[model samples]
Target: MAKEETVLQGMIDRLIEIGRCYGMEMNVEKTKLMKISRQPTPATIKIDQKQLENVKCFKYFGSLLTDDGRCSCEIKSRMAMAKAAFSKKKNLFTSKLDLNLRKKLVKCYISSIALYGAEIRTLRAVDQKHSESFEMWCWRRMEKISWTDYVRNEEVLFRVSEQRNILHEIRKWKANWIGRVLRRNCLLKEVIEGKIEGRV
Candidate 1:
């Protein structure tokens, strides 16, 4: 662990050198650093005598990543994004389309948005509840069922002829991702197995 900062600095220096060789300059001022740890301390990485800002959370490839290595925030962000996406196509989803086709559309669009990078997420009971709630929200909105109607989730599922399968889908995705990772001889597999050298 003590060598982590040194190794990171070395990598940064090498990257800078390569950029210079390619006539490309790195914008150190715009660069951010994040360290994932249960008890994280401040990291000071300097470039051109300017310290890079350390962030508690940041977005990468449309997914929220936090210093605590927890995916709760990411899940919440995904839910929000999914809701926004649903709102954009609210007319189509709530149109007079066939129930089966609407369900399939929800699965392909809203669910995909919500489940982006879900395979790498570590979901707790609360996260699972949030996901289920998002799933129900989608169904309720598609059916144009008002919250004041006080319709039960089972009734909603029955009306939609569907089951609560978001959690199941996430689990399946995670299982498949794990299988692929286990079969590969790569850095990710080594990291998952805690077999990386110089890692504490």
Candidate 2:
């Protein structure tokens, strides 16, 4: 606690000093400190002698990051946002529209939002379940299938002329990221290569 607090305070003090030099001061009231740790200790982090609030979760890159490295919150948040996107454009997607066009719109708008930052997450089984279910939910809505209709997810995908491979899409993205990282001679590659605890 003491070490992190001192470091944070030092950073804040330096920022304030630099801002004074540039004649542009930061709003201490608006500044917040978010420490990423699974086990966080209570510490009063001050900015400009004013206490900055410590947040449990912070938004980064488009995903919600918590102190714990779990994807449940991110999955739920994405689902809610995706449902909102779908509901907002529900009127525009008419029944008379071509099935292919409806599928295209769902993929382009809704899926893009739901899966925006999913590639970086180390997804658990339940996280993947939510992602797959969300995809089928959108497909069913586009095909106008309801609970009353005894239709399976595969049937919904078939009706919409879509592929039942949302999980593979995420895997493909992860693979692409790994490929890029492997080819780069940078910090990420060095960090990954430096940690070699197991060799067989």
lDDT of each: 0.91, 0.78
Q: Scored by Cα lDDT, where does model 2 land?
A: 0.78
Q: Candidate 2, TM-score vs. the true structure? A: 0.80
Q: Candidate 1: deviation at residue 30, Å?
A: 1.2
Q: Backbone collision count in every prediction?
A: 0, 0
Candidate 2, pairs of clashing residues? none
- For residues 117-180, what per-residue lDDT tens digits would candidate 1 score against the true structure? 9999999999999999999999999999999999999999999998999999999999999988
Instruction: Give the best candidate by TM-score.
Output: 1
How far off is residue 10 in model 2, in Å?
A: 1.8
Error of 1 at 83 (Å): 0.9
Write down the TM-score of every candidate: 0.85, 0.80
Candidate 2 lDDT for residue 184: 61
- lDDT by residue (tens digit), candidate 2, 49-155: 67887777778777798766577898899889989999899866646777778778887898888888777888899888888888888877776789689998777
Off by over 4 Å in 2: 1-3, 92-94, 148-150, 186-200
Can you give the lDDT of residue 150 in candidate 1? 95
Spell out the clash pairs found in candidate 1: none
